[model samples]
Target: MDSDIFRHGGNTTCDIKQFTIITDKEMRNSMEYDVIIIGGGQAGLAMGFSLKQKNIHFVILDENEQTGMSWRKRYDSLHLFTPRSYSQLHGFHLKGDPNGFPEKNEIAAYLNAFKIKNDLPIIHQEKVIKLTQNEKQKFLVATPNKTHKAKQVVIATGAFYNPFVPNVHDGTANFEIHASQYRNPSQIPNGNVLIIGAGNTGVQIAAELSKTHQVTLSQSKPMKSIPQNIAGRSIFWWLETFRIGRAKPNSFIGKILREREPLIGNDYKTVQNNVEIVGRLSEIKEGKAYFNNGITKQVQNVIWATGYRNDYSWIQIDGVLSNQGRPLHSFGVTNVAGLYFIGLSWQRKRSSALIYGVSDDAKYIAQKIQQHEMK
Candidate 1:
């Protein structure tokens, strides 16, 4: 008899089969599938659609309790940097003005509806803890309570994982929150705010908070600013019209563009007049932030928009990730035979991580999986 323990809802655990229910036995037995995707975000859902088109039996394992939790958990005032036309998955158009940008909630709702409309099979609240390949070349994906066996696995967890906050803040701020955990200005204190990292998220939040509070933005490096609209059309239109959006990462144009990501919005302009911009944050001592340029500010609250790092530690497979824990693959195909990754920034082109670009990678990956099975 197998001595494996059965766990249910993270509360009950039992090793004796007599004490465990029939469903527990079923849970103990690994659910076999042809393909297993380790995320349920837009990338995973998009891959599901492609796999479904090819009649592949696959399942999306989502850590969240419901679909679109990733988007729903973002800042309340968040909006897509790309327009609706460029914010859609395969086969379904995001409703409303194609030229207009969608709100975070709208994107979340659309993702949920997309999963329902496509009838994609997803197992929610099953966060994959460990992924290892057996001698038979079958992947054993272990969650807290269940283990799934799949012939192939796709990691669509996207680029964001653990929030990356530097050691600049020495626990002196009255209150601090990462941009990932920030909701709105109301959630912040009424005093002056210091936002570290001048990325799009940092700039947008600084602009928003400048309306209600004194704000200072900390810039780590010089960020190129581009207008949201150029010549009365979205900048994306111009990029697409000139084929700049499709530039491969290895190309000269792609190399130049990737050198410094240009901020795509007028929010920087909006904040320039109201918010005080400073250089890199050197450190925080006694709730006072010292800049590298010998400037200091007394801030009541701090928001770290320092971005995220992809944590591939859960993926125990060798030769799939680089020394820095980034996926090492040509586009999405990894060196490992049955392993693949999607939704990585600059995975194939400039738009590989964007909503509109994932379908292309998904279709390609689904075809690759089909071909592998056929062989």
Candidate 2:
């Protein structure tokens, strides 16, 4: 990203440098560390900064080719839902107005600055394919090309795993793309578009496509919406002030907050009236999509904006994961010695997986690692 790529909301130019982007082949055949953190998203980066503050030896490994490609690869109009004040990680302040929301690229740039400023040790293009414990009571992380050893392993791989695209067996649409693969309006075919899943991504993508194409949102019911701002303050401010975002997972209030409520930001305001809402997709056959309510539409483009599922097949440890393949950690610490997780939804609280909230989990994990070392 260019240094002059300043956010108009904050009118601040990014002055910090970027980190070195390394590839898998460039990685050493073998490496060792006091701690190895997987996934260089907000959670992993936060842990890196916290560990560096304590002079701990650690390395962050992510499969992305660039420093912040995770956000950079998202759709063009994507922006942080929360205000800038609520979107920063540890050690590095985001260069945008506290009350303003930053676009996706701004976030990618901010993370690059965060990595460079804190001098976080990160290995790009390195995907951990397998994780197991050796008899020596240390972790052995295996990638396709190399192996790494660490006293502790922190899987900070943030959420948003594999895209869950519903397969209709019979190809009814000319083309289909998931929101993760969606870049811009041009990605959609020339004719009408059908968007599945009424979550945040589905609503956002439908809004974007309505600019040049007729869009029909296919879902069981319209996503619930909440006002982004209340009176003169952002909704996040209220959430923090009322302690709603930090509510316990099992609490009644937390359960209500965790329920998916599609937020319509500036991205969807204009297209709200232009798109059509339909029931859940019941079937697809002969170039026509049918919904549960007997609504049928001919669409050339289809966007599967469904949610994701956790994939921890690499973590070969028993009893560490639940039957559904989610990490069973308490505030980022697992019963497994020197094993931990961060950036998991509801890992500690409602905001635990989000950018603004990941630092809390990371800091907690760092302290736990330090305590474990003393034992």
Candidate 3:
């Protein structure tokens, strides 16, 4: 491999610092790679770094202007439930108190720094529009700028790309809101605010906004929450020690927990006192939301922290994705050869989606790719 291709023609050895301005037309018209990784979150970046370590000819395509844009775009008050030490990428540890969970900005900065330090090849602002398999079993990745041909393609886009809002009510258009549009409490006018979901995001946002506005949280079912710490140890420590996050999805324990566990923030109980919990919104008409329990409420803002849906319509490969649009895989390998998925929940184990756990999945996929290449 020519080292110059990895270099920036400057003293800097970091690929993140070395800027390259290749047009989409130029990339589509000319370049090809051994592998092309989609998404630039922790999983994608980790895979790219691992590929670079193996001297594999690969490139990563990200829709953002920089790596870790997903974290950067999150709500301002967001913080990881897991501590900073646990969130470190492969070959690098976060530079701070190990027990402390960093804020969103810190996480984003770490990912950016990790890419630069490792010289991972990433093309930002290059969105993948479609992915198709050719007759030769190679991948054709279509992006806004160009089409890329690669022997293998890794889809590392995190699960949070598509926001899941429930079907709109009759009067939904009359009211304004979706959690994705929420940047801050100021974006909502002062009045009663109805949050339509009771997940971690909905609960957290409700807790924060309740300080100034009357808030009501609507849940379709009763929610459960676990303390961030139990018996003087972080919840994560217990989970890791017992391999809770690594449980098989089909196992009895995994099935029970997945169905019963209510998504909660690091401080679950503390948030409940800050917001009013109510039943699901059965209907909405004339600016009033009707709950299942015969409660009628009038609200000025509705934050739909419902959840997210996975849509891989852009990917044209057959038998790779399940009916839900999530890639069907075992240890990151899809049904289609040379096409893989990472950073998905329950992809390899329960912990596959966590920032700390994604590197392990990436490593596994990287090793698999290496094995395939050797053959």
What C-alpha lDDT do the candidate models reach, one value each?
A: 0.85, 0.80, 0.77
Give the alpha carbon lDDT tens digit for every residue of 1-375 in model 1: 111111112221222122211232443354998899999999999898888877787888899987888898999899988998778787466767878999998888888887765667787788999999999989999999868999999999997889999986788999999999999889998899999999999999999999999999999898779987888898888998998888899999999989889898889898888999999999999989999999988889999999999888989889988888888899899998878898988888888899988888898998889988998
- Rank by lDDT, descending? 1, 2, 3
TM-score to native of every candidate shown? 0.91, 0.90, 0.89
Q: Give one digit per residue, the lDDT tens place, for model 3 in 1-375.
A: 222211222322333333344454555455688889999889898888777766777888888987767787888888887876567676466666767778888888888877765667778888999999788888899887668899988998876778877665765433466787677888888678898988788888888888888888998888788766688777888888998878877788788877886564544564577778889888777788889999998766778888888778998878987788767888778777788888888777777888878878887898888888887
Among the numbered candidates, top TM-score falls to 1
**Where does candidate 2 clash, by residue pair?**
219-280
Deviation in Å, model 3, residue 184 alpha carbon: 1.8
Model 1 residue runs over 4 Å out of place are 1-30
**Model 3, backbone clash pairs (residues 3+ apart or across chains), number:** 1
Model 2 lDDT at residue 167: 71
Native-to-model Cα distance after best TM-score fit, residue 261 in candidate 3, in Å: 2.9
Q: How many clashes (backbone N, Cα, C below 3 Å) per candidate?
A: 0, 1, 1
Question: Against the true structure, candidate 2 has what lDDT?
Answer: 0.80
Ten-residue stretch with the least lDDT total in model 3 = 1-10
